[model samples]
Target: MNNSIDTKRIVLAALFTAASFALSFIQIPIFPAAPWLMYDPSGIVCLLAALAFGPKLGAAVAILSWLPRVFLDPFGAPMGMLSTCCLIIPTAIIYAKSGNTRAGSIAGMVFGAALSIVAACALNLVVTPLYTAVTMEQVAGMILPILLPFNTLKMVINVVAGQVLLAPCMNVLHSSKA
Candidate 1:
């Protein structure tokens, strides 16, 4: 019985990860000024998995979801995957610790969104210069105008989408368990 349960969890995680992987392709530009900064629903998928399963499995989903991108888009994959992990881990941890309730999901997503904004700013300040000709100063200048609002909007979309899907996802998980 334990083995079966574990198998089900693994299968569920894999399925969520696969869905996230596919969702990564459906990117939309959130900021008109920064068209290169695209938003995807992959992170929301990871959050849903986290709420249904546990943080560990959610983290697994986040990492596995980015595997394809690592090979397909060598230039942006690393930073994108890192940023995604940064976003999902905090959300999962908060949700898991808060008892994984609907309220906890909302709280977790809010916290995670805030964290993502800061992390994006810091990462862009440090890493963006290494990849592009832009310096830290230039990136810093765009933080308030571009990165902040962009990340916030992206996270809002993720949080709202995750909340909207949470019921159906939980229903599926519960039914599967039975």
Candidate 2:
């Protein structure tokens, strides 16, 4: 029985990871000025795994999902992975600690979104210049106008999608427990 449960968890994680990786390819340009800053729903999938399982597993899924990009897209890989982790980890931890309730999910999403924005801004300030021709001053200047809004919008979308999908996911998870 224990082995079966573990197997189910592994399978679920693998599915979530693969789904996220596939979803990463479906990017939508959110900000017109920065078309390079595309949005993907992979984070939503990772957060769902976290909500259904636990933070560690969710994080594992997120890393696995983002691993492909790290090798294939060197320019934005580090920042992309870091930003996604910044969003998923905090939200997952909060949700897990709060007993995975609806309220906890909401709070976690809000907190995680805010944290992602800040982390993205700071990270871009430090790392953007390394990958692009942009200077530190340019990156700093763009943070408030571009980076902040972009990350906020992206996170909000993922949070809302996660919330909408939560009930169904919970149903499956609970049923699996039996």
Candidate 3:
């Protein structure tokens, strides 16, 4: 029985990783001002895994999902990974700590989204200048106008999507034990 459960977990983790990797290809330009900042639903899978399994597995899936992108977009991939982790880890931890209540889920998502936005902004200030043609001063200037809005919107979308899909995913994943 323990072996079966472990097998199920491994299978589910692989499924989540594959699904997230596939979903990363389907990007939508959410913010016109920053077309490079596309919205990908892969984070939804990470959230589901986090809520259903745990933060560690969620992070594992996030890393696996983002790994292929490292070759495709070296800088962007790391940024995406960081942002996704920032959004998911705190969420999973807080949700678990809150006794897994509905209110806890909501609070967790909110807090995670806020942290993701801040982290993205700070990362942009540092990393963007290193990779892109944008200077640190320019990146700082764009923070309020472009980065904040884009990151906020992206995080909001991820959080809302996670909320909408969590119960259904949990049901499918046999998340009663989660």
TM-score of each: 0.90, 0.92, 0.93
Cα lDDT tens digits, model 3, 86-170, are 9899999999999887788899999989988999999888898888788999999999989999989988888888888887887
Candidate 3 residues lying further than 4 Å off, grouped into runs, are 1-5, 175-178
Better-scoring candidate (TM-score), 1 or 2: 2
By lDDT, who's the top model here?
Answer: 3
Range of the 10 consecutive residues with the lowest summed lDDT in candidate 3:
1-10
lDDT of 2: 0.85
Instruction: Write down the lDDT of every candidate, Cα atoms only.
Output: 0.81, 0.85, 0.89
Report the C-alpha lDDT of model 2 over 1-178, residue by residue, as the tens digit. Answer: 3324477789889999999999999989998878989998888998898778777788888888888887788756667777777777888888878887889889998988888889888988888898789999999999888998898889889989999999998898788776
Per-model root-mean-square deviation over C-alphas: 2.1, 2.0, 2.4
* Candidate 1 lDDT for residue 166: 90
TM-score top scorer: 3
Clashing pairs in 2: none
lDDT of 1 by residue, 27-58 (tens): 89878999999988888898888777666677
